[model samples]
Target chain A: MNLDELYQTVILDHAQRPRNYGELPQATAFAEGNNPSCGDEVTVYVKLDANGEKIEDIKFKGAGCAISQASTSLMTVKLKGKTVAEASKFEKTFHDMMTAVTLPEYPQGFGDLQILEGVRKFPQRVKCATLGWNALKQALGGNSSHDPVTSENE
Target chain B: MINAEQLRNDFPILHQQVNGRPLVYLDNAATTQKPLSVIETLDHYYRKDNSNVHRGLHELSNRATEAYEHARRRTAQFINAASADEIVFTRGTTEGINLVANSWAFDNLKPGDEILLTEVEHHSNLVPWQLLAQRKGLKLRFVPALANGESLDLAALDSLLAPPVKLFAFVHISNTLGLINDAKQFCALAKSRGITTLIDAAQSSGHRPLDVRDLDCDFLVFSGHKMAGPTGIGILYGRAELLEKMSPWHGGGEMIAAANYESSTYKPAPHKFEAGTPNIADAIGLGAAMDYLDKIGRDNIAKHDMELAAYAYEKLSQLDFLRILGPKTNRAGLITFVMDGVHAHDVVEIANTYGVALRGGHHCNQPLMKKLGTPASARASFYLYNTKTEVDRLAEVLHKIKEYFTR
Candidate 1:
C-alpha cells in the first residue's frame, strides 16, 4: 500500500491537463457526479452519432480532486468512437476495478485506466476515482438530472 | 500561554498514532477531543448517578437532578448568562438555532418581516431560517462579507438592516475561514435599532471566554462537542424575559406542569424548552469540561490558539502557490487553503498518508463557498491540545502534497 501507487505519474499528468474538458454543445446527454463529503463535482457530457449508437464525442466540466478529474479525462479517451453498449461495459469494468480487492482482468482499451487500480487499497478514495465514471454511465443511459450522482447514493 | 505538550497527554485520544506517525488532529473546529476529566465524569455519571431526572422521587433521581441542574448553572456561569433559567440544554447548536427559529420567530415574525444574516453562517444557522422564511413567507436578507469571505463588512450591514429587519442572526466566528466577528459591535448595532440578535458561538465558545451579557445579544448558542465536552449536549442562552415570552419548542413529560386531554399548562423557561429526557450524562460531562477550561483559563487558551494559528499561517504562507483563506490578522484558530493546481480533497487524501487529519470541503457553508467563488478548500483547525510541532507536520505534509502534484 504505497502512496506512489495511489498517486501515479499518469494520473497526475491527466489531472493537470484534462482532455476534452468542457461542455459539449447540444448533442446528446449530460449528467453530474459528486463525492459530497469532499465537495468534488464532475459533470460529464456525451454526443452520439446519427444512429445514436456510437459516441462521437465526450466532454466533462467541473471542479474536483486529482483522481476524479484525471479519471474523467481518461474516460473521454476510452469512450470516444466506442458504441454506447461498449462504453457502458468499460464503465462497469472501471467501477469493478476501483472497488475490487484482488486485481481484476482489465477489459479492452482499459490500459490507461489500470492506473486507478490503486484506489482499491484506499476504501474512502474509491469514490473519488469513480465519481466521473458514474456520471458518464448516467449520461450514456440518458438520465438528464444534473442533481449529482454520488457513490453513496448508488 | 497554555502548555500544549502537557495538555496533549490529558486527551487520551491524542496519545495514539495514525499511519505509523504520531496523530496530528487539526479538525478541532469540527469537534474537539475530550480530556480524561470529561470522560471520567461521563463514566461516573452513567455508573453511579444513572436515573431519570425531575421525575423519580428516589435517591438516584435526586442526585441525577442535582447534577443536571448544577450543569445548567455551570454553563450559565461559563457564558455569563443572566441566570441558569436562561440556559436550555439542546441537542447541539443546530437544534438550539432551530428551536429559536421555530419557537421565537414562528410566534413573533410577520409575513413581510426580514431576518438579517451574514454570508459566513454555517448551515446550522442558515438552513433553519431559510426553512422558516419559506414556510411563513418571511423575507431573508444577507449582509455580505468582505471579498475574502472572512470578516463582515460593517459598512454594508447598515444598509442591509435598512427596514423591516426583525432579527439579526450571525456567527460569532466564521467556522470555515476562522474569522472572528465583532459580535459586540454587531449586537450593539442591532440593539440600537431595537431589533433582537442571536450569536452563533459554535466556534468562539470553545476557544475564548464568552460573556453573553457583555456581548449584549438576546440569545447565544453553542455546542459542547466543539468545546472538549461530549456530543448530544449544547446550551442556548436567552434573556429570561424573552424566554418567558417565547412558546415551547417541544412538548413532553418534564416540560409540563399539568397535562389535560386537550390543554396543558407548560412549565417555566428552560424546562419548557427541554422536553423528554435530556442528554443528562453529557450535560454533566460538559460541566466537567467547563471546570477543565476554567482551570486552564480561557484567556491563556485563546492566546495559545492564536499563536498556533499564526505559526501555521506563517509556515503555510511560505508556499507561493497556496491561497490561504480569511484575514491575516484577528483570525481564529484555523487555516483554510487551496493549492494552485491541486484540489482540497486531494491534498487531504495525500495528507492522510502522513497522519494529518484535515477538513476538506465547503465546511457546510455551500452558499458562502459559492459567494467566495471557491468550490472547496482544506481547513486545519487548532485547539489547546494542538502543538506548534503539529503545525510544522501539517506544513511538511502540505509541502509534500504540492511537490507530488507539481512533479
Candidate 2:
C-alpha cells in the first residue's frame, strides 16, 4: 500500500519524459489498448524488419496514469531491436513478475521494469501497469485489423 | 440538523481503518455503505424465512412472499408512487432503464421517431436508448449542456421537444457534474409536448426527498444500493396506466397466470415484470433501508448533504491548480475535479494511501466527459454518513497528492 513502491523514481522519470512516444507512419502492425474502467488508452505501433522477425521500431501514444504511461515507455525501450519471439517472452516475464505470489527474482536484462514489480502489491493497478503491454501483445500478434485490446479481458 | 457523527455509528463499515489511516469514504455516489439495520434484515431473512415466493404452499413461502411484497410497498412509499403495483423490482437502475427500453419503447416507438436525452446522462440512461434506437431505426438527439457544463440548456429544449420525439429521458442529478437538474420543470415541458418522460433518479433518490406524483414523471428508476440498501435490488416506478399497457421485459416462472405447452397467460403489472425467482432477501433489505431513511427524514439529509458539498467546494477551491467541475451552488453532495498535469487515477491512488476513498474515472458519463473535454477526472461524493471533518481529510489529501506529484 506504500505509494513510493508503486511510483518509483525511475517510473516517474519515464512517465514524465516518455521514450518513443508518438505514432509510427510505417507501422507493420498496430493496436489500441483501452482501460475502459478509467478511460486510459494506449495505441502501440510497431515496424518490423523486412524479414518480419525483428522489431525494428516501436512507438506508443496515449494518456494515462503514471504507472500505465511509464510501463509502456519502458516496454518500448526494452522491446526495440529484439526479435518478435523475444518480445513475447519479455512480455511473459513481465506478466509473471507482476503476478507472482512473492517478489520473484529479477532476471538479467530486467532493468527499469523491475520497478513495476511493486504493482503486485496493489492488485488494482496491475491492470494499469499492463495496459500498454496488452496493446503491444496485440500488435505483435498482427492485430492490424484495429481491434481494441481491453485490459478488462486480461 | 442531521448529526453525521451519530449516523456513522449505524454504518459499521465507516469505523474501520485503511492503509494505517482512518477511512474517509467519499465514494458514496458509486455505492453507499449499508447501515446495520439493512444488514440485519438480510441476515434475518436468510436465517428465518428462506423460500420461493408466490408458488409455494408452505408457511416459509408465505413469509418470504409477504416480506418480498412488503418491500415493493415500501419502495412505492419511498418514492410516493401511487400504489405498490406501480413499482417493478429490477436488478438495479440499469436493468430498470433497459426494461423500459425493451418493453415500452420497443412496442411504442416507430422507425423515424427520435428519443431526446440530455448530454449529461450516465451511460445506463444513454446506452439503452442508443441500442433501442439502432434496432428500431430510431434517431437519438441530445440536449446539450451549457457552457459551464453544470446544467442543461433549457432554451434549446423548445426545439428539441418538437414532434417525432416520442420520449425525453434524462438524469435527475449528474453523477459527474453533481448538478441537480429541475426534474419537475423538465417533466412539465415534456408533458406539454405530449412526450413521455423517464427520470434516472439513481443519484437523487436517497440523497433527497423524491415524489413521483409531485415531479409528474411518467417513469422513474432508482437503485437500492445507492440508498443504504443491498445490491441486486432496485425499483422502476411507472405510472399504473403505462405499466398496464406495456408488456413484460422478462418471461419466466413467477409471472405467469396460467401456463401450458400451448400458450400461457401473464399476471398484471409488477408481477409480470418480475419474472424469475427474484432477489427476495435483498428486496427485504431494501425495505429496511427505506425505513431507516424515513426515520432520519430525507429533508434533513438533503440539507446536510448540501452543507457538506458547499463546504467541500469552498475548501477545495483554495487549491490554485485544481479545476472544479459543476456549478458552485445548488449541486448535489459531490465534487468532481481535475488537477493540473495529473491524471485522475494518480490522484485517486495517492489519496487511497491516505485512507480516502474516491472514484477516479468518467463516473459512467463518458459522453459528458467528452463534452467537458477531459478524458477523466476524480470525484468525491458524500452521503448522510459523511461530515465536514471527512471533507477536510479529503482536501488535505488532495494537497499532499498535488505536492507529491509536482515535486
TM agreement with the true structure for every prediction = 0.96, 0.95
DockQ of each: 0.69, 0.74
lDDT of 2 by residue, B205-310 (tens): 9989999999999999999999999999998999999999999789889999999999898999989998999999999999999999999999998999889999
Position A3, candidate 1: lDDT: 88
Clashing pairs in 2: none
Q: Write the per-residue lDDT of candidate 1 for residues B303-341, one digit (tens) a residue.
A: 999999988889988989899989898778999998888
Tens digits of per-residue lDDT, candidate 2, A42-91, equal 99999999999999999999988889999999999998998998898888
| Model 1 ranges with Cα > 4 A deviation | A34-37, A99-109, A144-148, A152-154
